[model samples]
Target: MGRVRTTNKGLPRGLTIKDGRYYHVTTVAPRKWTPLGRDRSQALLAWAKLEGSEPDPSIKTFEVVSLRYEREVIPTKARRTQSDNLKELERLRAVFGRVMIEAIKPHHVRAYLDKRGQQAKARANREKALLSHIINKAREWGYTDAPNPCQGVKGFKEAGRDRYVSDSEFRAVWEKADQTLRDAMDLALLTGQRPADVLKIQRADLHDGALWIVQNKTGAKRAIEVTGELAALIERINARPRERLSAWLIQDDCGKPLGTFAMRSRFDKARTLAEVDFQFRDIRAKAATDTGDLAHSQKLLGHRNREMTEHYVRARIGERVQPLR
Candidate 1:
């Protein structure tokens, strides 16, 4: 037999087992009245054991946990990764804000995924993955004892893009692009680097006829051997008069580095003007195609694995094959 207590409201206090019913009360507001099912005798014994052990802290609402995660966990990621995660968090907070982290069930996760999948399957998939990370963080923080709700939810399959930019298309876009956009495009095309890494380059990165870069995504170091047009572009970029010398190589109309969003919008405008059906990222694949050497392209792009480099470059089947006659 165990001592049973009551609140001032004539309700069970904490986790109580009496009168063949089990009432599990938690600090999570929406989850205040949780029925841990029948089996009163077993509930009493479990409650007694819990009382004798260390006090378990109550779980917070998803909103509170999300704020904490943004403050703590989000900063640990790379800038581009952080930006994408922040967007996912925004959507998650809208749906799961008041829900108790521990009380989130697989059905709720399935429902959310279903709703988001309607708008964009790819976006929904990203959100699902981000949710798993958030749930894992909640578990790590001791906010939830429940298994991750996102674990069994099926993500919508997305088709892989095989859009490769042609050299003539690159030239068309370059011709139509403004000076600032042209500089960024040329750098990306020449180095076969990600737009984020390209924007991070500074005047100091150039030395001994090579562009030294520490990739922000993979943290891999590379010194791209500069020759021909790339070297000439760097020379012209350096010679351009500046109001104030900025550390960033790709400068905006003002002498500061252009932001990711602004650069993307500018590139979109250039694409429209040129009428080219390709993105800035496609330029990396284009660079890979031009090299005609997989290992050289992999090193140039600073991809630690060949698989990732393969994703960037398209295979030239014609070059590898004799006439199939």
Candidate 2:
């Protein structure tokens, strides 16, 4: 005897209403529940595609392709990027979920950008980029033969962040920060690495009088020569006592490695105490600007091109001129 449907009366076969949301129940053993949507009409459209005579007709819809992308592609990205992609996917689904992948055109994409840009221009640009990638993958996977609609649809212009933390501002935060937070900040400033990378540093990464770094975002590798203040800082961190021994350079009182969230929380508290407006990330810009050499800053930041390094240090530093002798 087939499973009796008591609830979800008047809904289509294989679709059930749960907590005021529609879910599609798979026919196979160990059935999976796929969320259709909150809107009844949209859920019905998705149900039709799933139950259609065409084999796996769901692949033809933007929602299904996005699901596949989320499952297969998202996990391979950096942790931060994966988080951002999921948020972008949520926004994209609200707009394009029920639409046929092939039916999407440039105008639809532009319209999305125009509406979403009103709220957050930078975020809209990021979402459009994610959409373009999704469409490209859909084409490659044979879900759609139409050209990517996001192409040539211009995104809103965005300005780069130019906030620079001054020496006094940096000192104020440093004074308020605890020892662990101070170590993290020092590592960030000295190596010019990102918060994630700085927190992941291990004693093993230090060898041959250099601190080796494999950047999480770009996968770029750098071996920063250990000398002067950097060398002393590493020694001090290693000498610090903890309840437990860990290989990680940056650690809390318990000796467990500090994650980004903990680091940010500590930084926020310190920032509040210092009464400074500059962000933790601004320290990177400060490092680049203080270096005062384009080539040196480029190398220190491990940028693929000098242009990127220049952008980091630009607008924060004033031009130096010489008066007529």
Candidate 3:
């Protein structure tokens, strides 16, 4: 015979059937404890009643939640930048595999954040933010009943970065860069495009007086007017030996599409030769930041919000002269 189940004192309580069977009731979590057997199951049920509530999660909870998130959340709706953060989560699971969620206290998260933040201020800051989002979502998914662990940790404090490429730096880079890289660098500065975006430009994207392309990095479609400077650069490249490449204005010497790392390597070497401290992204930031209107700058940068572009601007050309405590 099975135990008779009932709500005791308005709190769901563990009930023992008239038979040797038992049903453990967890009111808070409201999950069932159904173990198969007669006397043995009943004995376990009795023990559960005496203990009250489910046992704490095991150490493997962290890996479990992370797996669920990557499968269910990260792929479907995450943007490009958000996807980058998810990659970081993949990295964390590799080293700290099988850690329990609750077992991970504030100190553990802080230590991880501190170690990574020291490498790249901007990228680390993004991971810190992404970690918070993931943990909060975990709670909502009923994985953990506690608050987000990242909530208690201090995130990476960012130092201001310089984004402006001085005229001398620009000249030096242009003179020293290889043909493909020089075109890319010119396009990056001219259109204020991200390096990832610049490398994807195809010949077909060029039109009368303008370039038309969808920013692959952000999926933002744009048609920027080709100024005389940009046109001149395109003409210069057109005169070069044609590498039967399928990509737009910029391509590898063999005409293979330039990947992000390759493009960056080229740019870094060029910056070094030019003695410039600025990265390719600083061009976009400086162009957007130095402009008069924040709203216009955001649109040009293909950012959805003013705040996103504003920070880049601030990093490069913000009111640094203003006094702050």
Candidate 4:
């Protein structure tokens, strides 16, 4: 009687198409729609499960494994990494959601890279890396026994950023920065820490005649000895008038802890006024290069190896060399 069941004639009862994808329409008074993906075969398998019928043994969708990964594995990563992984997963799901987990091959990954790389090469590389990790996790979770398709597929080569902020450039930005921005800049440069790590610095972290730091990204711990300019800087920070007492070393005018977003907003305004091309993060590289001692810079920057420190201390200006006689 339902108008002779016009479209999708072969579809099972309660399963229908909507907006280019298949959905299972609930039979109850308040109808609920559950997405079963766009592929006919995959959609039918999903409908079979909803109907309490046994699904085919050989068919397991990538969407199934990816959803499981999102529910289980993605939560264990760092906050920023988790955010990035979710975005990458959404993109991957759009292409491979209906494909069988075991059916993905190296060529499929390469094809994805070829297409995605056109828009953002570096971002594509990151997405591919996340996909590789997801597939590996799928294996561990018993979703699929197939080998990772991302393996043997090469990612595009990426060059490290080599923008070195010169002394004049530093001074330009510094002159334009407010007191709060200046404090952040000074701390980042003096401690040779990342912006996130610098923003997390607290009063309790200062002890044992040093400013103790636990890097957010690497979990590396360091105790930068509080002396000379660093000692004076801390004194200056402490002496600043505040309406309310705060534990965080970096606070806004109202004594609220300065967050990365606020700090970045402030930095952007200052950088625009100064007309400088460099970033707030460049201060760390400047610190490493100015230290002039490889070993000392390595320790100061909390790098595990000398080579890693060398990447940060790239010569922005002309390299100094002995003149030929």
Candidate 5:
């Protein structure tokens, strides 16, 4: 015999009979559940019992929430930011991928911070920040109702970089650098631009002794005037003939754009040869110091505000020391 069909003559407030089945309506999550039978009275009792109650461990695991975050959240960030987040996510997955979202506590965050801080304090701070953002996103997306574990964690004190490359050190690195590294180094020193912007420079970007660049991170457009040695160096790179010409101004032997890792590695090799203890970014400060003009350096570096430009302009020490009369 077929199942008994229940008529909705006196069903209670949270129970409804549709077709031949009775469903218990849930109040908390706005969902319906099957009571497995067609008895309207029993189903109504079940609905009343389950009303105003939370589901058992409705939160997803860390891996599940993180995957969702990677899909929906990470893509919305800038390319450089997205790359950084992915790296942080990789580290997080190894530590907490299998753990439940609600099970994470402040102690776990502190432990991660302590261990990572030992390696690099700045990196630890960044990871902790990223962790806080990810957990908050999880709550917002309904994956978990737990508090963010990283909220109680403290960031490390950052000692910002102030090691500007001196003229002597710059000459040493230049002498030791190969052709490709020399090209990159010259452009960075002349324009006071980031390595990313320097690598993205194309032959077509040059016009009438000036190179127009749109900074990737800040989106600031500036026309950098090339003259003297800078103009001569650019002319040399442009004059190189290729079987299939590349668009990039900074190219490898095969006429292709140099990858960031490759460029850094080559630059590092040159630094080691020269025994210099400064980074490629320090070239910007050196350029700013060489100009002795804040406004001109700010414009060449494409800084929207003078505050950031000031950071790159190092003071010429001992130039104004008062002698004892």
Candidate 6:
């Protein structure tokens, strides 16, 4: 028989049986009042075993319910969306400060919702959505018996659709951009493609006076003819000695592949200089939503279903008319 250890709260510390089948107790599970029993303690053990650790299990307790939502869930689903979910989670953890997850109530979530609403509508929605994701994940993973409490909570409403990059803004951005940024922006605009698609384009894909391909975002196969302007852009690019087909065409001086993140600094500076604050993706959406060339724009956008494309156009995009002087 081993010594039965206890916590500061005098609760028996996560107990361990040194029997042939190992049994360990934990209070780390959010909203779980009783300690969890595990035969395989590798996960909790790893945390302890890592360098610069404490002997007490209280270091790992989850009291902040929203923190539990972030840590236990967000990364698993919606992996495609770009967000600093973990960073935001750390902020939550700091605010909650070693509180147990299962110990938290809806009031904690409500406080977060109220504070988030004061910041911005998007901020409120992000917190709420993250909470919903956590709750759903908990239910999915058997952490919670009930469905997520965040399912129907209305935190705030988005005002929406003032974010479009107008035509003059695009032209100004294009004119202001250096060669590297220009080529990068051109691929995004002309192809009506995602930033990743534009950056990852292979030289082999440009042939027959057309930019042909299967789009990675939708997996749709489509082709768009390179008109004289776009063709001229290609000709000038080809005239330069670019990195090999194995490497990305739109690379830095060192020929490293241009990550979307790495180029965003350029986007920020150039858009500011050009006096446009919209995101690069807004350019793609604008191209996709061109009402005059609906069929052609849809093909370029690689929208499999017209309804999906129509919604993206109708709601998210606007005609990029030149700004009135």
Best prediction by lDDT: 2
Better of 1 and 3 by lDDT: 1
Could you tell me how far off, in angstroms, the CA of residue 238 lies in candidate 3 after the best superposition?
3.6
Per-residue lDDT value at 112 in model 5: 92
Identify the candidate with maximal TM-score. 2
Give lDDT for model 6: 0.61
What TM-score quantifies how close candidate 2 is to the native fold?
0.81
Candidate 3: give the clashing pairs.
3-17, 59-100, 201-248, 202-248, 203-248
Worst 10-residue lDDT window for candidate 5 reads 2-11
Q: What's the true lDDT of residue 147 in model 6?
A: 43
Please write out the lDDT profile of model 2 over residues 1-325, one tens digit for every residue. 8866576534546878889898999889999999998755456667768877323645587887876676568878887898798789879988997789999999999999999999999999999999999999998988878889998899998887878888999999999999999999998998888888888999899999899999999999999999999999988987887898798999998988999889899999999999998877788778888888989999988899988887677767755669999
Model 6 alpha-carbon miss at residue 135, Å? 2.1
2 or 3, greater by lDDT: 2
Cα-based lDDT at residue 213, candidate 3? 65
For all predictions, the C-alpha RMSD in Å is: 12.8, 6.8, 14.7, 7.7, 14.8, 10.1
Candidate 6 local lDDT, 1-325, one digit each (tens)? 6554442221224433343332334445652232233322232343233323433433333333443343344434333442456445544555454554344456777777788677666866775665566555545645556645564566776665545567788888878776778888887877788887788776788778787777655667767788877788777776676454344567765566677777887888888888877888887887776545667766678776677666677676543568789
- Candidate 3 local Cα displacement, residue 222, angstroms: 2.5
Q: What's each prediction's TM-score?
A: 0.76, 0.81, 0.66, 0.79, 0.72, 0.63
> Which candidate do you rate higher for TM-score, 2 or 3?
2
CA lDDT, every model vs. true structure: 0.77, 0.85, 0.66, 0.83, 0.76, 0.61
lDDT winner between candidates 2 and 5 = 2
User: What TM-score should be assigned to candidate 6?
Assistant: 0.63
Residue 22, candidate 3: alpha-carbon lDDT? 44
Query: Per-residue lDDT of 1-325 in model 3, one digit per residue for the tens?
Result: 5444342211123534435454554445667665434433234434445666443434336656665555456655425654575567756665454576656666777788778777876676676676677678767867667767777676666666765766677778778788887777777776777777777788888887688867766678778887778788888877788657555667766767877788788878887877777777776765675566788777677888877776777766556575685
Displacement of residue 156 (Cα, Å) in model 1 is 0.9
For model 3, the superposed segments whose C-alpha errors exceed 4 Å read 1-60, 77-83, 94-96, 114-126, 207-209, 216-219, 289-296, 303-311, 314-325
